[model samples]
Target: MDNLKFENILGWKVPEGSLPCWVISESERLFSIKEKKPFYDYSPCCYFKITQRLDNNFIEGHLGHSEYKGKRFHDDISTSYEYFSNYQKREPVYFSFDRVSLYRLIEIIPNKPLSFILKRVDSPKAIKPNRAFMIMPFKIENLDNFYQSYIKNYLKTEFNIDIYRADDFNDNDIIIETIYNQIEQSEFIIVETSHPNKNVFFEFGYAVAKDKEIITIQNTEIEKNLFFDRAHIRAIFYSFDNIDPFQKQLEHY
Candidate 1:
């Protein structure tokens, strides 16, 4: 980004010896008047919003939807319109201010030219959402069928989140690795501490190490002997009749 050069910022009213700030405004192009103190030159299309930063990087604000005209931008100063109109689709008009970063401007600008300049602005590597998460419930066998049914049914109904059972683990490390990776990326995790299996405890610890937000539930009575910190991590205490309570706890998770 340091190697890239940007045009200029508009509507910046920065005091000398200050950092940059973002603002919305009506009209004014902010720049170094004498390469020292800043000033504004009000023009015809000078109606735009301006926010001042300690420094001089100004982000131009529009009141409403606008069109990226060939050499100018057309926007309303009252409300944000539904969508901006189409322009001649020529080169983007870059207001001349000095403090804004080129990469940031590229992101804010529309109709940017596609070439080496754009390649530097748009990074090819980025993460995508919509990946599925798998969950594994511990002590599945020890729990009564009613309890198992309650856990599975409530998880899907309340959160609409899914998990794969640890029992599904095959001899393939690739499968296990994929499952673990998905868990690390999951938005929320649930670990049933009910009559814990060794693997479940390991999974719980792994989830904690990964800093995954977790919801812990236990069917057994809360153990006073457990460390206070561990007890604090528990999200819910559930029994046969306490399904509603469990659901309530998960509703906000």
Candidate 2:
């Protein structure tokens, strides 16, 4: 075990009696936006034990949750991890987990693994699995109708896959939390970048960091204005008069 590189353990089953692991984060714990006040209440630590090796890039595990009094609150919770190496980031790779909400594990004990798992926990209430997440500027003019007519209807009717956007959530829902949750549940992401929107870019970055399948779309008018760095990326350029081709292009993904 001492000589094992983190990458070598990718497909190795975590045997019983292996050391317990804790996920530590350098970043501050995020709170719900609906509170209107920041609450620095929770610890940045999460405990878990790897149970089974899913593949070269993922692992199945049980998450540990303890109460304030040091009593174990939850154990053997089913979860899966997405390896950090998949994203090809220069920064310290972190494990992204979807449990009560989206969270990351920056470090682990025993052996510091190069790859971290993106975990998805099963919710008590079954959520309809989302096919794609639409990341676009919500304030764009007549965009809702366009989404309703072309994007949403097209995906549903042609592929039988549901798509969600930030606007679909209720007003009471916390904005960032809801966005992360939806992205976690989605199999792929579709980003509209016709307009240079900070929020859209942020979402796109998040999706990329998570190594999600990304499909970018842009309006023909502003296609020249796309970020120079991202120009090489293939994007579907569409117009109001002709969106069928774009819809058909999405079907292959």
Candidate 3:
């Protein structure tokens, strides 16, 4: 339970382009981002691919690569739960991903020059299914009908998960604190991107940089809504009141 507040900085000119994760100031909670370069790494990654933490200061890529080429499990916990195994790299100009892809991960470590053309392969999914957090627009109509009556119950029943929704709380003082706690504790996150909600997207970006399991739900594809929305992430597109198919697509999890 590392309840430490994340570090944030202002006036940072992140290398221009499609960059998402490592470029983020050391921690995922950093709020101010300055766009400097014209590059974004939407490269694809799968299991057994090279990887590393994005915030590593070293200019190399050899810290958290696949070890023993095997998965780890715990005796007390169920193996059904997936984990985002630690994959921090540094050397030869280290880089990282937001790890926000729906079904796959995009791991592209560049050379000292920061050119991400070295290895563009698919990386396996990293997840911890024990806990999940939900983020959505706060001012939506019929809030109870849209969430409590439908989404919440449906998810709890289908996935048998322990979920934490932000709006469920009434303490404004603790909302941000709880949010940080919930996001850190939750193994996966259910983001409602149905609307161009900056709060929701900001939280989504936080989850991406933290390397948490992300499950995004959107009414439609609004490319303009998300500044870091160029990558291919598995999104469940559904109309309000229709959730049958949403359950089906979640099987990919």
Candidate 4:
């Protein structure tokens, strides 16, 4: 088993032998088997050993860490092989591994059924943009301050991107035309669908029709009130007390 040659699996090299093996590395952290790439970002300060490879397309492993937060902690890491296999069958699987404070994507051989890639799925690049046009119920009291202080400021400080609302424009053009023009000029759209506002829905539909990047944010209290037609769409839920997580989510795009 020691003499067996290994191949790249995401950021790790896996041996060809069938027996369970422990991969020990001093500097190497994250590896991609398909791309044969290595990423050092948020590399776990630990070692991993493949424990079992099940016939049901699942692989189990143990993560043994020497030190974490000035203490030792280890746990079992189990994942299904079918997840990566099915994903690779269609397109390359690019994903990240969350390490508490930081994360990174390590691609793996999509054809290898036993391979595991973990983390949040990467967002599509088509909707990523440097500027976002925000559509919300601006008439609502205190909503303007929330946008300016929480949403707009956060985007500017963290992502250095400009976010504009309808009030940002000073042109004397018709309201609908002005909005459409703003949508045309912006790279992406951020829709606040927390409330049942028809204007926001119309703007969202227009943005979708234009094939623009779209991100939806809503207050958690309004989840049950989400329109039936838009219920299936994913949205970032937030509350006044917990807006940081949503801001962090937006930074990814």
7-80, model 2: which lDDT tens digit per residue? Answer: 24333322232322333232322222333222224332334445565553445444433222232313212223
Give the lDDT of residue 208 in candidate 3: 84
Best by TM-score: 2
Of models 1 and 4, which has the larger lDDT? Answer: 4
Those runs of model 4 whose alpha carbons end farther than 4 Å from true positions after fitting are 1-129, 171-173
> Cα RMSD (Å) between model 2 and the true structure?
16.7
Off by over 4 Å in 2: 1-99, 102-130
Model 3: worst 10 consecutive residues (lDDT sum): 1-10
- Using lDDT, rank the candidates from best to worst: 2, 4, 3, 1
Superposed Cα RMSD, model 3? 17.6
Worst 10 residues of 1 by lDDT: 114-123
TM per prediction:
0.41, 0.50, 0.44, 0.46
Q: What is the lDDT of residue 23 in candidate 2?
A: 37
RMSD of each: 18.9, 16.7, 17.6, 19.9
Ranking by TM-score: 2, 4, 3, 1
Residue by residue across 94-185, what tens digits does model 3's lDDT show? 13343321111233334332212223222223233566888887766764466675567766787677677886643421245447556755
Winner by TM-score between candidate 2 and candidate 1:
2
Model 3 scores a C-alpha lDDT of 0.45
Q: Which stretches of candidate 1 lie over 4 Å from their true place?
A: 1-139, 142-148, 221-226
| lDDT at residue 132 of model 2 (Cα atoms) | 75
Q: Which of 2 and 4 is ahead in lDDT?
A: 2
